[model samples]
Structure formats: structure tokens, C-alpha cells
Target: MDTTLEELYTQYPDTVKKNRKKHIVIKSEADVACPQIEANTRTIPGIISQRGCAYAGCKGVVVAPIKDMITITHGPVGCGYYSWGTRRNKARADSTTPKDKIYSQLCFTTDMQEPDIVFGGDKKLARMIDEIVAAFHPRGINICSTCPIGLIGDDIGAVAKAATERHGIQVLAYACEGYKGVSQSAGHHIANNTIMQNVIGKGNERKPGKHVINVLGEYNIGGDGWEQERILKDCGYTVNCVMTGDASYEDIKNLHLADLNLVQCHRSINYIAEMMETKYGTPWLKVNFVGVEATNESLRQMAKCFSDPELEKQTEEVIARETARIEPALEQFRKICRGKKAFAFVGGSRSHHYQHLLKDLGMEVVVAGYEFAHRDDYEGRQVIPTIKSDADSKNIPELHLKADEKLYREGNEYLNLSKEQFEALKKEVPLNYYEGMYPDMKNGDIMIDDCNHYELEELIKKLRPDLIFTGVRDKYIAEKMGIPAKQMHSYDYAGPYAGYNGAINFANDVAHTLTTPAWKMIVPPWERIEEPDTGKQEGAN
Candidate 1:
């Protein structure tokens, strides 16, 4: 009795229906490969999409998390105000190199108004940078331009240069206008470029360690980064820096000196990772710490990268210890959560990463989608070259990068692997490859791109999933329809959901949400009556 996807599409106009059909696909057992969904395209005008703007991607996600920098929004107050402390990128001042340099607690803005917009806000941005330098005396300052500044053609880069010279502090600017791309992905790219140009590779101080590594693409959401750091430290690896989460200015500068780079959330930070490899000859590895198995695998991969017998032995021991500690709780939750159905519509990597945890809970992901993921995210990295650039994508600049002759390593000697050894290493560890969401999903599953509310409502009506995983925007809507919804974005403002303990916490949380007694009372007993069916045309007969 459920409406089919075809029937749902009939409601839209011809062009709209045709375009939307490509984005909504059903997996079939007969298919040799996963169905391709059109991604990184503009959202339909009337659809309520969960996608955030490019500025949100850049300033909010990438730049603001650095605890030591004064990130000033170089436009209207609303842009800066809304993004301030929203992501919950937790930082510990006591843990930083210079304990006094923490500034993630404060929100700085140019607060551009009508007058500023009419005649450019560059002067205001420059003055704000000077004030920040004088008052905070922070290690650095990052200025991000909102939509109006881009429209008015304000030169933020010029202002940054002058401010840097005047204050004798590092100043960087990002032209991450809100409308640059289809979503926040563009802003992420811009932020990465700016950071690479200004912040990275400036420090001379070096930390002493044999297996030093940089944790890239982690924003420390709800202490997720902290948990990851704890596990890595336990394995006897020196975590030189986390890309941005709870990161200090000094930690960022010395990233070039790292032996390796471990990338967690690849979509937002892959640009910097790739650039770092090219510039610094620092080899990178893709890592996922979202699930227990994923964390175990990621740790093993890191150990393999080092190819040290002692490190590998320690990693295995740590894995065994952590697994023993959390197995009982995991088993209990799995028993309670078996056969539950789940639907996920979240950000780029989460739609895939959280699948590992859901499977650990014995839940099946019936439907999944990304708000702003491109082909590389949904499909694998192999499709990166095949993907044609559109106007929106083309608007974002790709910086011309050349190797730093002094810093770049000449050969694969850093990897400590010969040609034959490297070939054998792939069998033990996956390097420079990402088999995306498709390979993980099963037949009869659904995959969507840039999923909107209408599609979600329709899918909910048809699938009647037991749990929904998405952002806060759609959480209440799913709950209103009598389903338990867990937020993957902010982790419902509670987590350390990135290791062995985190996996147990996630499984327990899902079990608790699904087994709660409150859902039984959604409709009272009085409303459960079935209406009597009147015999058709009995009087006429």
C-alpha cells in the first residue's frame, strides 16, 4: 500500500521530476554496481535542504576551531554570531603549547552594516584586525568574508597584508562567500587553501619522536578528537597535531615536520592533506575512528605505515585491551537493538562512517544520503578526474602549488617501503585509496544526494524506519512521526564517539532510544479503534 518513488516523482513538473529522479536511486540485486546519483548540484529552489552555505564550510567548520587564532568574520554580524560556538569544537587551554593563547571562546566580527556595505568593509576589517592584535595579542588572526563583502568586491587579502605588516602577526583572509558553491564544500576548499598559504610550515621548533603523525580532518566534535588522540597516544605514536580541533597556532605551523598524516573526515580536509603531501612529501593515510572495528583497522593501518614491530605489537595489545573492556556492553546493546531499521541523511563522510556503528548495533541502514557530498564522496576517488566542473565549482579557485625544494622528500624513503615492499604493504594496509559508500551498502538499499524534506517524509512513510540519523534541523520532524532520531552532526551534544568506548556508547544510545517506553504512548488506546466498513450500495441492491 506504500507509494512508489515513481509515483512520488509524478507530483513534480516534468523538468523537476527528471532532474530529481537522478538523485533518488534504488539499489537492485541484479545491478553489478551501485546506481549513480547526481551530486554537488544546486538544490531545487523550493526544497528544504539541510545544506549549509560555503561560508559555513570555511569559517565555521575549518577556521573557527583553531583555539589560538582570533577568527574575525569580515562582514555582517549575523554570519559571525550564528557560527560562534555552534560546532562545539572543544578546546583545553591548559593542554595548549602556550596556555595563554586560547581564543576559541571569543567571537570577533567586523559587524558590517548598510554604510559599510555601500562603501566596502575592507577598512573596518583592517581596523578590527589591529584592535584584535592590540587587545588579544594572539598568535594569529583569520579574516573570513561573508556574502556582502564578496558582492561589493572588498579586497580582504589586501587588508590582511597591511594588517600583518602593521601588527607583526600572521594575518590571513578567506573569500568564502556564502553563495560560491552548491554547499559548504566550497568554503572548505577556500579555507584549506588560505591555511596552507599562511599558517602551515612557519614554525622552526620541532618535537622529538620517531613515529610522529598529524591527525587531519578531525574537528574534535563533542570530544571525538580527544578520544582519537588518547587511543593514538596509547599506541605510542606521537600525535604532532590535530588539523584544527582544539589545535593551537604553533601545532598548525609545525605540521610539515610530521612523518605521516592521518585523515579522518576526508571531504573537508582532503585538499590540505593532498597539498601537504605535494609540498612537504608527508605521506597520508585515510582513517575512520567512528566504529570499534574502524578504529581497530585504522590503528592497525597506522602501525603498518610505520612498519615497526614494536609499534605493531603495542597497537595489537591496545586493541585487545580496549576490545575486552567494551565487548560486554556492545553485546548487550546488540541484543537489544537487533533487526532495527535505520535511515541516515547527514554530511559527507558521516552518512558512511556512522554505518559502521549502526551495523555494530545489529541495525540495517535502509536509506542513506549526503547533504553536500560530491561524486568522490558517494562514488570513489577514481571518479575525481571524470567529474566535470560546473560554474559553481569553477568559481572556487584552485591554487597553483609547487613543491618546497627544501622540505620535500626526494623518494618513498620516508614511507620506509621499497617498490616490492610497498606492493606487499597494500595487502596489509589500504593506502591512497578510498572505496566509497556504494561498496558498503547492500542490495535493495536507497541512496540519495542532497536529500530534501519532501523525499525524507515520503521515504519515512514508505519505510517506517525504527531510527533516523541526521542533523538537528530534521531531528524533531522524524520524532514527530513517531521514530527515534539521533543526530550525527553534533552527536546530540554528547559524545567521545570515535573509539572503542565511543562505539559502545553509540550502540547503547541507539538501544536506549529505540527501547524507550515513551513511543508506546504516542497514540492513546481511545484512538486505536478501527472504523466499521459499511456495505457498499446495500440499500440500492
Candidate 2:
């Protein structure tokens, strides 16, 4: 028999159990409202969490992916060194291109020392920026502060301004300290604010295209961005810019030119999407390209937004072509994978995104959670206003914004339809709607917030899932216990898992991981042998 969540809570001490119970919940059909799980809260000390710090969120996840800019970590060497090339956010640059346009391979750092921390690192930071520009002559420089700089109160913003004036290049600084928030979510917000304040809207040039859109929050991990762009182009739409994945500084500067924005990972980059819409009058839509069904739906939505029949026809044709190509392979995997149980504990958006793929593969997700996601991620954006700001959240800056008088296009043609027309349009494509994760999940399934290693191990023992999807840190741990685990964050260094081809690749990978002969050897052959009457005779003696 399966152990109940209530039964599991009994194992912990009084205080620990009380606190943990709020975070771990099993959905019940009786509850009409969304299940409340304690999220975006600080991890209890002594529990090993998979959450990354705020600096990692800003520098590693967001800023580092811009291929043309040199991202400098303005603190200790370890923070810069460890984050360099850690995430496989692949960027393609031609050697034939100018030297100033490519700098993704380089890891720049101020390398703050004890003395600098004691006084201030402003002078050193300014000198480092000057040296970097003179040496590399890059298009821009992004300075990210670590925990030490935040603690000592280094004036990185002043240094950034000085450097920009001297070098005649775009220089931006992020005050995303590691201790600012509970996790990397805080860092994402900080990065978005900095980019909006500095990089975006500096240029007035608009790339000529009928349907221009920006694919936001896509880091292009494992060529995911490349695949997404390919699909968009095939559907006769112009991909004005990807938020950061394989992105150039020049391309991002003209983001205001795009007519619409398609948000892929809402948790990380929704701030930018909302800000852009308010400032540039570019409407935004939430999109998921992780699974075959999701990709089809997202494409359909894009077509409806443009309200172009020709574009809609092209989108359907591409979907038909791609679906027909992979249908046979997907069926075979589904047949083999039916009735298999899976668990996912990953970063924000992934824990939800992978569910669509898993369901397509005929698997059941028994447990899922997010490491750094807030209540909005689980309960949808509708609850954003109701969530009370705690001390940790209050520290993060909330920028006040106003629409550009010159650029703002109020009641544009695309959105100028009447109430009845808009309703009909929505039937073909959803607009400004996201139902969140809990509503989509099964009633009995477990939904946890900020899941830790101890809870993961305990759940594995009870659930005994056929497979697990999480980060690299938990991969071997699951595999050691005789279950196959796939890294969803980096796709275990294998991907393009964001389009039609990626859906097929993901299905095959899941089947291959589970059915591998190595997993069968976890228990010795002798362990399965029956000793017959010999055990009874020994007991008699």
C-alpha cells in the first residue's frame, strides 16, 4: 500500500513536521481553490536544497547567455569561475564575424580581494572594466555582483556609469546579491530590470517583417532556441529576437520594434514581457514549446494573434508536417512507456513543462515540485496581487514604469476587435491566460514547494517511481537507488528539446533511459533466488 502524506509527516520532529507539512500537499478534489503550498520561502537550515543563489540567477541564468557581451562577475574568483560554462546555454558565432561581436567563450571577473572588500571595490571595478574594454573592445559589458560586494556595500552602479562614459559602450551593473531572496527567482527579476533600464529600446531600427515577435525567457540550452526559431521562421513569422539564447546585443536593443512577445518560461522572464508591453505596446502571450502538443498550441496561438489567414495556414501546414514525421516513433515509445510512474523536481517552469512530455509518453507523474519558484508559478499569475510581500521579497526592487508616448500604440489593429470578435479569436487562440500547475495536475498527485534531498529520498523510497526528472545533482542519487533519472535543466547535455524534433528526441531518451540493461543489474541475481525449505530447517534448529 502507498504511504499517505499525513503518515510521512509523523516521522519528523514537531516543529519540522509543522513547517514541512505546509510545503508538501496532496491535491484533493473537494478543494475548489488552488492548493496552497508554502513557496519562495527560505530553506530550513540543515536541509540540502537544490536551489541556486540570487547571483547565480542573475549572472548564470540571464546575463551570461548574451553572446556578444562580456559578463564580468564583480566579486570573488570562485563565483565567476564556477558559473563559467556551467549551464550549456549554447551560442553559435562564426569565426568570420568581427571580434567585437563574439565574447561568449570568455569568463571575465573583477577578482575582488580581502583588502578591496574591507574598503570598497569601486576603484578596482572601474579599472577592471577599462582593462576589459581596451583588451577585448567588446560591444558591451555586464557586471554582476556576488555576496561579498552586497555585504560590503560596493558602489557597482557608480563604477558602471563611469566605465560606460569612458569606454563609449553599454555598461550595466546588477545588485543581485546571493542573500537577497530565498532563491534565483530574485536574481531573474534583477536581471530583467537592469536589461530594461539599459539594453532595451536604445535603437529605433525595425527589422522588416509581416509578423514580428520576440521569443522571451528562452536560454537556448542545448540548441533549444535554434529549434524554436526554425519553427517560427518556417511558419512565415519573423523571430525579431530571442531574449538571451544565442542573442546579440544589437538584436536585443531593438526589441521595442517587435509587434508581439511569446513568453516560454514565464517564471524567469515574465517581468521583461510585462515591462515591454507597458512600454512599447507590444502584446505578450505565454507559450510552451517543450512538448509536441504544447508546440502545436503555441504556434496556433501565435497565428491567431496576428489574425492573418495566410499565416494560420502556414502554421497548420508546419504542424501537420512535423506531427506526421514523428507520430510513428512517438507511438512506439508510448506503447512501451505506458503505465510507468515518474517524478520531477526541477527548476521553475520545468517541473510543469516536462509534465506535458511525460503525459504524451503515456507516463503518470506521481510527484513534482520546484526549487526556486514562487506561489505564482504554482497557482498562476492571477494570485500575484494577493501574495503578501515578506522581508525577503521586499528587498527586491519593483521598478515603476510608464508607456513611451511616442512608441505606445494604444488599441492597435490586432487588439482593436470588438468583444464578440475577441471572444471568437480566443476560441482559436488563448490570450493573457494561464491556469497554473496545480489545476493541470491530477487530484491525488503530490505537489511540493522547495523540495530538498531528504524529502526526495524519502519520496523515492515510498513511490518507487520508474523514472525521475531533475537536475544533475539528483541524477546519480536516483540512479543509485535503481531508478533512471534524466536531467531536465541542461537536458543532461543532450537536447534541442523545445520543438517538433525535440519532442521525439525526448520520448526516445526517456524510453532508452528506463529500458537500459544497466538498471537491471542493480540487484544481484542471487538476491532474486529462492532458498526453498533450507530457511525453515535453520529456524527449527
For candidate 2, write residues 89-202 as lDDT tens digits: 988763323555788777988898889999898899898888888888888899999999988999888888888899899899999888878999999999999999888998
| lDDT score, candidate 2, position 111 | 90
| C-alpha lDDT values of all predictions | 0.85, 0.85
- For model 1, residues 1-541, the per-residue Cα lDDT tens digits are 1147877787789998988988876777787765677999999898899999999999999999999988998888999999889888889874454667888878998999999989888888877777788788988889888999889999988998898899888888889999988999999999999889887999876668778888998999899899998999999988888879988888899888888888888889989888987787777888999988888988988898877999999999999999999988899999988898899998889989988888877888989999988887877888888889989999988877889988888325566778677678767776666777887888878888987887787778777899999998998778877778999888877787888878877887888899898877675223467767786765785
Cα lDDT of candidate 2 equals: 0.85
TM-score of each: 0.94, 0.93
Candidate 1 C-alpha error for residue 487, in Å: 1.4
All-Cα superposition RMSD per candidate: 5.0, 4.8
